[model samples]
Target: MAEITTEDGVQIDLVSGERMKKLRSMEKIRLILDGVRDGNIVILEEGLSPDEESKLIEVTMTEISPDEFAGIEIESYPQQEPNPGFFSRLFGHNPPNKLTVIGPANRIETLHKDKNLIRALVT
Candidate 1:
């Protein structure tokens, strides 16, 4: 379970497993709608399943919030870098850029190609 605070400062416990299941069930569409209406951003500790994550993207694309509930902003923060050795570079890759999605959770980092994708994701 993950603890998520709403914009109103109320904390809600979100069981990732349960929420995923709910999102897969008949409640999915409605739940997505509710999430948008409340101006809440969803965060998963380890991330979400592909299907569930896709649903979130779809829902976010459609829901239009009121001025008071405008969606949050997401920004990418690239890590300072010193290129690693050839072996290290070959064996492992650096982490994707960090993204802080400001809203209920204050910050979240996601690897993305560019700021446009970040903007699309946050909206």
Candidate 2:
């Protein structure tokens, strides 16, 4: 795992993932934002709720600059939502529970290219 220190000299581990499930939804969102802002790839094992996913994308998009880098890349492993209600079943629609990654395109690409690293951190 990579590490970085802030100006206040707080050392933070750069590699993180699903173990954060105990955090409240907005707290998790804050961590994601902080990681991305600091140019670190973030992984989420349990993934985000649909609303959180949308909000993440929206917030990240706004944070990007045309002059800085092209964009952020989001990747995910989609899982079926458990115990869909009758309406969801009847409508033949089940939104997925996604294992999401979000970060700068190049770094995110590097992380994706190394399956071993991904396995080590997320597993």
Task: Give the Å error, residue 8, model 1.
Answer: 6.1
TM-score (all chains, Cα) for each model: 0.37, 0.58
Give per-residue CA lDDT, model 1, range 4-118, as digits (tens). Answer: 6657564433435445444443364455335534655543322343344456456555554454444333333454357667886797655433332323212223446463455
TM-score of candidate 1 versus the correct structure, residues matched by position: 0.37
Best by lDDT: 2
Error of 2 at 50 (Å): 1.3
C-alpha displacement of 81 in model 2, angstroms? 4.6
lDDT of 1 at 7: 73
Worst 10 residues of 1 by lDDT: 99-108
